[model samples]
Target: MLNRLFLPSIFALLIYGFWVSAEFKVIAAGVAVFLMGMVYLEKGFKLYTGGLLENILKKTTSTLFKSVSFGLATTSLLQSSSLVSVIVISFLSAGLIGLETAVGIIFGANLGSTAGAWLLAVFGLKIDLSSYAMPMLVFGLLLNTRAAKPLKGMGYILIGVAFLFLGIHYMKEGFDKFQSSIDLSAFHIDGIYGILVYTFLGAAATVIMQSTNALMVLVFSALAVGQLDYVNSLAIVIGSNIGTTVTTVIGAIGANAQGKRLAAAHLLFNVVTAIVGVVALNPLMVTVDEIATLFGIHPHDYTLKLAIFHSLFNIIGIALFIPFIKLLVKWLKSLFNDSYSKEPLNLAKIDESSMERAIYLNPAVLSYPDAAMRALTKESGRLYRNTLELICYGIYFSGEQLRNTDNLSELAENWEKEEQPWSIKGLYIRHIKGIYADIIHFAGALEGNLPRQQAQELFALKVACRNFVQAIKHVKHIYKNMGKYIESENDEIRHQYNQLRLCLASVLKLVDILGVRRNYNHIQEHAAQLKLELHEQDQQTYSTLNKLIRSEQVDSYMASSLLNDSAHVHDACTNLIDGAVIMITRDREEYREYDLAGFTPAAQKTSS
Candidate 1:
């Protein structure tokens, strides 16, 4: 509803402004062009998102000071606090960085944003930039047409810079011309009332434009043209500072609870900063003037003074809040608890027709490769848990019993005594299929910015999901026959089917242990032992089947069904073990030992 109203209103305002003054139209056009340039500039920077920026972010955010410095340096270089905010939120959602570190980055981003004002005030207004813009636009356009992706990205950046310069030039010219016909200075308010009103206007302009850097550029250009008073400009700066959080808020809308908490922290930080700036407006202005005088800047240079004020207030905000980052994180956690913490384990209550939405995967995290990889890995873990449940229940044993350290034979005996009417297809449709589909869809949606190593990891995860689903299907194939034979009056057939259940259940138990064991050496050791045990079990099962058939205890049909069903069970166990190995090992070095061991299943070795 707000979007519906906001668009038409903006259009109407633009039309009215153009009708009232040709100068207004030129200024509006300049703002439009500059915003477009910002879009291109952000796009160009994204080309480097694959691993370089993500790695730097991961490394730099270890300490609060480093996080702040990273935020400051990144925003200063990019000249877009909104981009920094988005990256911070992405990292937070992906669990790559803690919330306190994310807040620190945001605080530094606020300080770093002031650099744009300084750049424009010190150089943009002092010289004619239009002369430089023409050549930049020419080169940028040429580069944009290049075949290489990086070259094209560079071209877009060049064009963006050219557009920014041209836009500033046009805005200055239009505002200067408008000063002759209309004195915006006449409308300037004084005292607290004026500060509040102009601050709101500043925030509203930024919210509408969705770029504080653009808004600052306009403010500086207007100030240079004598169309905006120094006091009013400061008010607008305060408002713009507060307004910058809108982008992050919007980005967090579809994110997980952690993302929302980070976004809330961002908004809280900015609001506090804005409030302090407004309350201390007079004192800060005096400080800005004093700093200006110390640096040999002319007292009459309001543009430069405004830049100093912008940095000064943000620095004060950072200094005031830096010590309390932990408290802020604690507060945010209390406010927004983890969304998945309370998920019900009742399989019977699952909605069969509902699309299983991704719990960890969100588009907001896609721009940061590290974050994207983390989200995908976490989602895969969720899928594995659900699939584990389905597999356990399909075998007539409850997932709880399989996960526990109880004897598999005892658990299978206890379950067999009851009338277990398990529905493998219903469970697969209700619990497994939806999550598997979601995982596949999320993997397909990942951006190409992921590092090659991370990309391979993602592929491994997808393959794990596939292997798990295949394991379920194999189990489904044997479930009916196992169920019928387990209740048979024939003692030999009933015993054989029970052994099949025990074998599969033992594999499930080992997998449960593998999922929780963290030590690298221990996991590899256990996995090796498990491979041997499964191999021994397969040999024993075949031996028993041959004895029963030779002794005439089982008919040919019974022997054939037992052999095929046993193979299905073996195949399912092998797939589950392979998938577990992939999920547990962190790196190729850890995987090398397993690969060298060449622990192929008997069926595969025999077939080959």
Candidate 2:
């Protein structure tokens, strides 16, 4: 509703302004071009999103100071606090960085925005950026036609820069022309109400324009042309600072609870900063003038003074809040609990039509490769858990038995005297197929955009999904026999079947250990060791089968059934081990090709 009401109202105002004064067209054109440039700029940056920026954000956000520096630097380069804020929101949603880190970045971005003010005031207002803009636009559009992604991204960035230049030029020219027709100084008011009114106007304009950098350009250009009072423009700056959070707030709407918490923190920081700037308005202005004088800025050059004031305001805000970040984070966590988390669904209870879907795979996280990659891995882990559950229930091994260190031999035994075993095939279609398809579809959509490292990571996830399904298929193939013979009247077959169950339970136990532990070397160690154990188990099972057949303790038919079922058991073990390793391990190394663990299951023939 705000979008609907706001856009039409803005258009109406622009149209009326154009009718009243032709200069309004040039100003409006500048804002439009500037906004378009910002869009291109953000897109250009995002094109490189898969690994480069994401890895940096993850590593650098370890401390409050580092997070703030990253925010400030990126916002300075990007030239739009709004874009920076939104990107931070996406990062937060992906679970890459914490709320404290995110808030630090946002606070720093406010300071970074002042860099744009300094550039515009000192250079943008005085120089003919239009000349530079023309060449950039030409070069950018030409490169944009290239097929390579790097070239395309550079082109978009150039075009964005060009548009920003042209925009500033047009706005300056418009205001210059407007000074002759009407003195905007006449519209300027004084006192507390005036300060409040102008501040609100600045914030409202920023929210509507969706770029505080653009709003700053407008304010600076208008002030340069005597169309705005220096004090009034400063008030607008305060408002613009508050309004910058709008972009983050909007971005967070579709994100997870973590994203919303970060957005709230951004809003809180800016609002508090605005309040400080307002209450200390006179003193800050005095300080700005003093700083301006110290730096040899002419007394009449309010634009430069405004830049100093902008930087000072944010600096003061950061200084005031940096110490309390931990406390703030604790409060935020209390305020925004993880109520978004869903209750774990029982695989046995799910309807085939309404099988589980991806939890972490949301459209909001897809904007950044790092976020999307993390989310994919997380969702795959969830699927792995569900598959484990289905495998346990299908084979008549109690799920609860796998939780602790009860003897594997004891846990492996089928405790149920009489119970309905879930159909493994039914569980696959009902629980695995839909979620697997969703993961596949999501991964497919992200194929080309990722860097080699990120792409490979994404591929690892797909392979894990396939292997998981393959594991299920192997279980499904042997499900009926395992259920029938676990309590068979024949002692030899029952003991052998229990041994097969123990083999599976052992592998499941390692997988459970991998899931809980975060030590990578230990995971690799355990995964390699499990493969060895499965290989040993395969040899032992073969020997036992031969012994049973030769002694005639089991019939030829039972021997043949055991032979076929053993192969299925071996394949299933291989699948679970390999798949679990891939799902958990970040560095795949050459371990994925360990022995015969990468065996292609019979499910490979199906049109998955």
Best by TM-score: 1
Model 1 clashing residue pairs (backbone): 50-449
The models' CA-based lDDT, in order, is 0.81, 0.82
> Over the stretch 1-608, how does candidate 1's per-residue lDDT look in tens digits?
98899899999999999999998988998898889888888888887666678788878888999999999999998889998888878777766777888888888899999988988999988898889999999999999999787998899899988988988888888888988888888998988999999999999999999998889888998898788889999999999988899999998988778889978988888899999999999999899988998999999999999999999989998988888888888888999877454453445344445435567777777765666877788777777787777776666666766766467776666664444443788777766787788778877778365545666667767767887999999999987887688889999999888888888888777777767874556665666677788788879978998899899999999888988988888888878877877777644453322221244323233434
Model 2 lDDT per residue over 340-397, tens place: 3354445444444555566456566667777788878877877887788778776775
Clashing pairs for model 2 are: none
The CA-based lDDT of model 1 is what? 0.81
Off by over 4 Å in 1: 342-356, 368-370, 396-431, 447-460, 476-498, 509-543, 549-565, 581-608
lDDT of 2 at 16: 95
